[model samples]
Target: MNRISLPALFITLVLTALMSATSVLSQDSPSRVLRAGAYAADITPTTFPVESSGSMTRRTADKAHDPLHARCLVIDNGETQIAIVTCDSCMIPREIYDAAKEAASRITGIPTQHILCSATHTHTAASATPTFQSPAAENYVGFLTEQITQSIVRAHSQLEPARIGWAIGNNPRQVFNRRWFLRPGVSINDPFDRGSDRVRMNPPANSRDLLQPAGPVDPEVPVLAVQAIDGRPIAVWANYSLHYVGGVPADSLSADYFGQFARQIADLIDAGETEPPFVAAMTNGTSGDINNINFFEGGGHQQPFEQIRIVAGDVAASAQSAYQRVRFETWVPIKMRETEIELGVRRPDKDEIARAQKLIEDAAPGPWSDRRLIYANETLDLAKYPAAVKVKLQAIRIGDLGIVSSPCETFVETGLAIKQLSPLKPTFTIELANGYNGYLPTPGQHALGGYETWRCKSSYLSVDAEPKLRQTLLALLGEVAR
Candidate 1:
């Protein structure tokens, strides 16, 4: 063996030690920590005489029975961050949704596409659409957009070490299929025709003339629980497939059962900590064809507030059960993906346009009192839109949980189909997300010819829109899961 110089040997040993130390340091460096934050902004309008635009009738609310809010939950895991915002409104128009998201994105570094903004579909909330424009409505819209952005900013600022868990439970009793097939000779007339429809939406429950439901009900209530490092509850986001429980005092603004449900869940959890306490949000599920009314037994005579309390309590119970079944994990992955789908708008034929014009012309020059007149106006409004509309579909994967959101009032079957096709074992569908275009009825349901299938502003999408949206959402879900 040849003898090596002592100085050269010392230099070689030192270099090796340095390389080893660097490797050890790289291995020992801390990984990204999971963080979460919850925030709520009071979006209730201070101005009086606000337009409430869910029903066909034109109504304005002078007072609010309960406070309305824009609730936000932001989660960040080193590589990705997502913000979920739930607002109390009948349906946020796409224009407002986009503006709000842009504002929030500018305030926080989170991309606008990553923010999943949705409305609670509460009929009693303030109207933000140009169709229902009023002095109060315009002011409320401006206020709401600013407040929503503020909510996301507040949430991002408060990010702290946190863990999240999710669980799913069922509440089949509260939700029922709103559309039902009628017995022979009981068909109702379609909007443009004097003939009868095979099925009618919200058919009288007591009527012996009705057959089975037209669609299936989705009863899964998925709850995502976020807790601080010390295990204190930070936020609880729950989703249910029941439409708004009406019977609220007329002309009174309320968050519908959605607002009640969230407060009740927070109380049940006893989430009392920090200055802001815990925020609970209830997002609408695929309930376009679902409601709280028990059509089988006919309408119940429960008082207005009583109905809200009962429904809220029942939903809170379900959420609590799901909460108990979940296991919080501090280390997980967060991912978000969004896709824009351009769909053809269903256009009316010449004959339909003539009928719509005739209806509008024949009406007396005044506020609309009849539902038919309102629908006729809606038809004209929809006819003025472009041939195609672009909608956004978003999928967020947080660990093992997958959440898919859409802008339409999706039917329960469509939601079920999404969950069935999703790569995630248990997926949740959030309807009226990003914004509300109209009711999205499956092609099969459209063929059945019911209230939801009527061609108007509220249900103006093309017959093939549902399948197209479903496929796009599934693709996004798969991308995020991968």
Candidate 2:
């Protein structure tokens, strides 16, 4: 404004240029920052005498041995955001998950499609979906929905600059194929009085009639770990293809090995108390035909919850070993793609329904003791279902790691096939995600005629579901990889 020196003017001009450049750099820096947050929201039922799921008989739990949780992890890579949640329940219906996602999306600005909600398949948790003889507890379902929504909102609010890494670990000792082919002399009878079953589920342990496992087990333990910029653990999400290790007292509610794995992993990794407590979620993988029972060995009698602790400890150790090998990346491109595919349902015909009605009318008035009567009731219920259902499938890409989800109790072979054929080098599939669509046995497995192939609400998906789901998931993986 006044008469200034030429040198001063030159200095002022240079400073202005520098300031403009710095502003541009600052604006662009956000794209390089990767943010993550996690929280374990308690979803344990407040009231007692809640109905428990995952059994053929009606059972109620008066109290919880351990608290259940909806473990949530939210990840954002500047451009894309995703939330992954694993609830400690046997199986959650699609309506519940849809409601939670919509509520979370309204608050967190995350698209409903970007959220992947799954059940850990813990058999002792309060029922949220009617299965077998267990009916859904209406009050608990509402409470669970609110808790799941809050978990995502809280996790989103705690987002901070974080790094992530993943690795695959091996724990072949824990996973065993529960379905087995029996000897020729041993009779395999279905609930419908048909002795045509080629395979039997949970056959007598160490029985001479047991020939060999009907299917192979997936021993791969895939772990995805996230940590803050200062190296504090944010969350660890691990997957294993083993059904729940059931040893909980029949009268008590528990999260089974899934909850124990979370605690064990937190302890193993020294993830002590922090501001936003660390979360570890053990997701159920493709374990429809897999379980912890060793049909080959005469297993010793384990006290209540002893087997749960043992399996959890061993799996946590495997996760820690993989955690040690992780090479955390400060930022990586994140991509998630979701799609829905309609599949046919295995509905019972009129003749089958008539037979089922007759069986129910003739049966004694009490809890069902005969498997034939139980399946007959299932036939009547399945008759009311629609001819088709739409299953949701999602694929996520975080750097080189890929994850695909199926809303079913998927078979181990399907998972293995997906891993082998995925465009990504190391891909893992999460089962019972987004919704409950019943058991997904391969057509070949269905041909073998086993408990998993029985026509009920739990196994009503068409025989072709496995192949269609596999193809669609791989296609989704291809889409995200690009």
Candidate 3:
């Protein structure tokens, strides 16, 4: 190198600066935690309401609106910059998820790994999962995706430091086991036994049963509330094992019982007695075997639509009870962990496949539902293995409070597992938080064959996903804490 004149020296300095600028432009900056806020958009589903339940119209009505729900949560927990959007829909194809993540990244500098988008698994809402390939909902999905991304961006702009709290309350009575195992040649539903309606129910299948009695029950209603320092409710999320969707027959889009309860939380909090700008984001937990108003059990509550309000009241009461009795704290590290774990999907025996073909050929009835029959027929050609299974389990530690996400419809056993092993003084599990992959049964429950135990064709993972998932979640908790 040679000494340069003053003019040459200045030119060289400018060139060096330009080179450095080019290098910086070529790569993304080292990621860092950022501010957070949330925004929600309403895209409620609609259809002509038919009098399936308690409606003034014994005939029908036109275009009854069903409420769909969605929310975006921005978390700057000091570890990862995360943007989570929870939608009350069927499923959002992996593409929508990726696009949403990309949008969040572009708008807020959050990486896809840091962005978590999930479905609430409401049948009443528009289908996000292209898995079923609905030509009708395609436009709705696109519309919803944009809305969600915008919500994330808006929330990011409104980011502020917030304190979070966790509380546990028992609405244990509301959720119950829906699965009943038949003994070797037992009734699926006992007609002799007095039904909830006094009218007996015919057994679904009364022959060649192996087991007896009702199946498992998960009674965990995990409540996690987040509030700003100013005492404004940022969001209230809940997980309870109650399968109470009412499974609407028509097109009317509604968030079902879950949305009703969520609104109840908002109502309770927004009464000016507590705080303003509070949002309630409720999730479903291990409700694979749980239901609130059973068809054969309680004569369907005699009230259908009101069931939403009824459970909403229950959740509101429980949440208020928890709020009144619980303590609050902040400044805890929130760590979210998700893993792709392979589960053992069902593969019927070769003989059974052959037998099924023969039965179909003979025009004889099969032992499975139309869906199940289809699954069985296609199981052989099933290219899916390792299931690309993704379980999003998260632990948010706020001072002494802890909140964890059980991605599956975790069985009540799964919640107990978290509570038993969690290092946090108190931990709550929020269901349907991350995504919906159907039921997650305990090891033994898998032995009892039913809808809950029926292996999904997509995940093709283990029926015994609960225990292993619980252990893996605990390990993630350790990593985040450490």
Candidate 4:
């Protein structure tokens, strides 16, 4: 050392310092186990224009703005962090979500992949994407993004050393399948009817089509209970497969059934029966075909109050069962990964585009080509230009639990396939997470014509879909293990 050259000494010192800094940074990160904090803001508008139905006051739920609807959770080991933001509305555009992710990454030193932005898919909720048909919905996008981002930033500052545990229970009874292949003879005339079609087709979706359990169901309701060091619960993340929110009415701002579900958990925890001060939110699972407001059922898509209570009971029971099933909770390694896959698009031919343009300018605009409509306009543009097939996929493995988000409503059969190869003891698959891609059928389903079964609409994409999703999940698991 005494005889070392100046150049050699400088190089050795730089290498030593780099190694020391790397070790300290790694220790501060949540690569292995971490603590989390959560916060949500009620974004219901203070005032809004609306109408109502029998006994249902539009003003009861409708307000000045759409609910900012945020779920901010932190993934951290004290020093480093990442936060997840989910809203109750239509899909958040990938670009918008990415921007928020970038902002969070800059502050927390966590990669964009670690920041998740998901949606609750409430039809009553306003669209958060730009270009809304109604000014109200467009205003919602701006309002929601600001509030959600603020919530994420707030949640990080509120992080407390907490414990997290998960459990699962049955939830199929709350929702039923709305699609069925009408058997021969049943028709609009027949009560217990099943009808036959020449295309050998199903009724598509009849208000009267009875539920025919066509595939495997993951009825388990998974719940993650997050508690403070004082044993007070901060939040309970719940997941279920049903898709009905009985509270939804025109212009209303309620979070629907999920809200009720959350309140139930809060009450239980507040009573000191479980964990106090807990926030419970139910995440929507593969519900592309599930409906809770069954017009097909006795509810007739109308409120009975009794119907709300009944469904609430079902949700509560499922959530309770999940609460009882926490096997273990030693902060396990977590790997959060995202990949862009194609959902497929419907690009019109040169002639089709020309015809559409003429129709839009001259004739009455088609529902799919309305210039003033946000969704329709996007559809129109997609027809003029083919949409890229880049859907985002996420994989998060917490200890032995693997949770994957397939933004598209994954087919039951396809979900079964993923589970078959999953390495985690339990793999929770959530769809419509970031944005919606309609119903994601198998690559084979594209050949079999049907509404959700087919990818004819511009929103219906099919590129880099199935295989990319699988690879993304596997690759993520590998990364987390590292």
Candidate 5:
């Protein structure tokens, strides 16, 4: 037996006791848990003969083929809480969105900044902007606010210990770049201008007739899966870039493929009455110049409701793959930050404004020659009001996933750039969030000249607005990540 010095023995005993105490403390402490809940509210118009927004032509829908909803998902990581609400509407105007968010914040105790609201951009949905002062449009705004607020509150009340997983899956076959580059001398003059555009929207589907696509398509379908602590799924939120998949009959209000896709996903996951109320949502992605029409194959010939089913099935499969790939985390950091900026509207020059006024004044009030001219008149009307518009940008960091949202119809390239520059590993962009300010095309695309770049109420932002919005969103992402 070796003899040990008294001081050495004492030191060794102290160290052992400290290690034992540390182990006991670590074992005694409770593990932090992630909590999540989902709720959806029916926001379909109650009154009949409602004007559904989309084209320059006014369309009234007395019936709804499918139910429209305001879906919400609430996530909490012990320290921070985030509420993501998506509405099936053409556009949620800033005023209405602000009111709804404020009410939700008060009811749920989540900060107004923490609530990120977005629109699914379904053209068949009721108009929420109230730009035309139509009775149905104006009344629907109040109804929409109440439904969304109730959704957030209900989600908050249902929060339970849960695990979250995020993944990105590719579905490149569905979405296509809508803007096309026509062959030389194939440019046609739009009603807004006598000048012909080198690049135009929805060119002939035949490849031999067109040069190529003017832009790129973002085929990424990002999914966030929420599951109970016992491994039961609660909800699946997926984002895609294709614009509305229109297959509805005339004068019919619907959520289009978004509502269909959610139902399909829920069924695929087997979320039924036996299990917890499982909610699924498909949020609109950066698709300012993207849509479901595969011009390369053919245009205007797609079978009506069949295409929606096909697209929904494909997206559901992609969601399943993504869910399988991600590793669910029970505890993770969650943070949310928002920023608001005012950007000047791109007003028409005096000459163009005068011409538009003259055209509207000279024509009879019955009907205009072309529908595009009506949009031109709307531009002049808007010019008489505000010179600038406020844009809301938000960023949320959940573990390794980063989500950035913009109120404008963002372009695919902008979304890609944000994802690439994000500090978080997997980033996704949500467009038409909080409010809708029209298409946000890059300056380079603006130079190419297309329907998206045309200066009208539909897309009224200044030329530099895209860059400004991009930089602001990036900065917000960095802040939240830190």
Candidate 6:
């Protein structure tokens, strides 16, 4: 009934058109909602007397001291999804991990590159890869592949609206640099008889000859936690630079401190029973040169598995302290990038091979009485490896937190350097991930010459491998951060 002016009509029409355009745009690209899911899939071998892979000599476990698991966590930001799995084993080969990832990708609609699988480096777990005298348990490998694949599938199926956060905790009392420099005149007693090593690995505790640690230990415990929209705990993923805590009884399969941490953290956070059970994973960080042993202060004797329990309790407490401070975010962008780089292998030459052959033929061999013989055999084995091998490296970004992974038992120095230089505010490294290349020692650490730098199946990467891998990882992190 009111008289409409020309200017009022024009303005009304313009406002209506603008509102319609905005509604169409909003409908086309809705706001992203973050969702997360987690599962702990049992990976314990069904058969007994399976070979264990972490020891220098062949060792078989007849029974399971504790169940092993493949802890899986899936995060989705509507536009992208990523799956991370940490298995309770010593180290898994690339072939097995590839098979698992391919199968998981097919079912979950996640790309193979979006999945990151790693080992917990538990010394007492079943063997899936041949290392030293232990041969790969074919049956267990097959079983493990299936289990890992299912872990991802089940985790994806459980996805629900969730909030996520991360924080860093410090626990320096547990980690120590195991490689040490001895006083003047003390022989290093290199297994290869090179007589070039200036430092010794795991020297006697409290020995007067001990001069100083050759490397530094990383004590930062980075934790990522996810919870339901209703404040129900979902999962906690924590990383530490200390290697496995080994005090398990012989002929028994255990997950070392890794499994203990999972159980204790659940209790510490009061993640009680739920329809979809809460999951926790403790992943191994850059710990090639770090261990629980404190050579400066000698440790007293303890019962079997006692050391593992003590270490797990202390670390879980540290994680809980950090978990309490996390500020949950309802939505965060997720990004992951993977790349492969070729690295030269420290293969033995003709002269080295001939010497190794001679040593094997001359030695009275019934289980290799001397450590030199073990290394002599390693030289011959290394000669058959390819001159160059490709190693996979990955970087992941969740909000302001960054995680980079290497397929090696990486040194703490490399992790520290990555954290310091990464564009993301807080960054951490996961070692022995995706595949098993070998131990990664920086050029400076390699110069000092310890067990980790010895040329063998366990430590065969070229001298420059660490620098190349570190740079590549930093570049990937930069890409994801952008």
Candidate 1 least-lDDT 10 residues: 130-139
Per-candidate Cα lDDT values, in order, are 0.86, 0.93, 0.58, 0.58, 0.85, 0.94
| Candidate 3, position 229, lDDT | 67
Q: Which residues of candidate 6, in runs, are more than 4 Å off? A: 1-3, 6-11
Q: Point to the candidate with the largest lDDT.
A: 6
Best by TM-score: 6
TM-score of 6: 0.98
lDDT of 1: 0.86
Instruction: Report the C-alpha lDDT of model 5 over 197-281, residue by residue, as the tens digit.
Output: 6788887676776888988999999999999988888888899998888887768888888998989887777776535588889
lDDT of model 1 at position 7:
100
Report the C-alpha lDDT of model 1 over 356-438, residue by residue, as the tens digit.
78987998964676656666766777778888888989999989899999899899999999999899868998889987778
lDDT by residue for model 4 over 161-223, one digit each (tens)? Answer: 676677766766666554454444554221111122211222334434443434345566777
Rate residue 172 of model 2 by lDDT: 95
Tens digits of per-residue lDDT, candidate 3, 1-482, equal 98789999999999999999978965654333323466666655433332121111122223434566667777676555666677776555556766767876887887666666666655555555422212235445577767777767876777777766667767765665556554443433211121222111123333243233355555555566666767677776676666555645454556777777777777776733443245566666556556664323344334546766777788778877776555556555555555555555555556656754654565544333354344444443343344345555555554555556655666676776777788876766666555555567777766544445543332334766777777877776666555
Q: Candidate 2: where is the Cα deviation over 4 Å?
A: 1-30
For model 2 the TM-score comes to 0.95
Instruction: Score candidate 4 by TM-score against the native.
Output: 0.75
Ordering by TM-score: 6, 2, 1, 5, 4, 3
TM-score of each: 0.93, 0.95, 0.73, 0.75, 0.92, 0.98
Model 4 spans > 4 angstroms off = 1-33, 46-68, 78-80, 130-136, 184-216, 271-277, 293-309, 327-330, 342-344, 350-381, 453-458
The residue-level lDDT of candidate 2 at 410 comes to 96
Per-residue C-alpha lDDT of model 2 across residues 1-482, encoded as one tens digit per residue: 78989999999999999999999988877678899999889999999889999899999999999999999999999989999999999999999999999999999999999999999999999999898877899889999999999999999999999999999999998989989999888888899877789999999999999999999999999999999999999999999998899999889999999999999999999996776799999999999999998888859998999999999999999999999999999999899999999999999888888889999999896479789888998998899999999999999999989999999999999999999999887899889999999999999999999999999879999988899999999999999999
Q: Which stretches in model 5 have alpha-carbon errors above 4 Å?
A: 1-31, 130-136, 299-303, 366-369
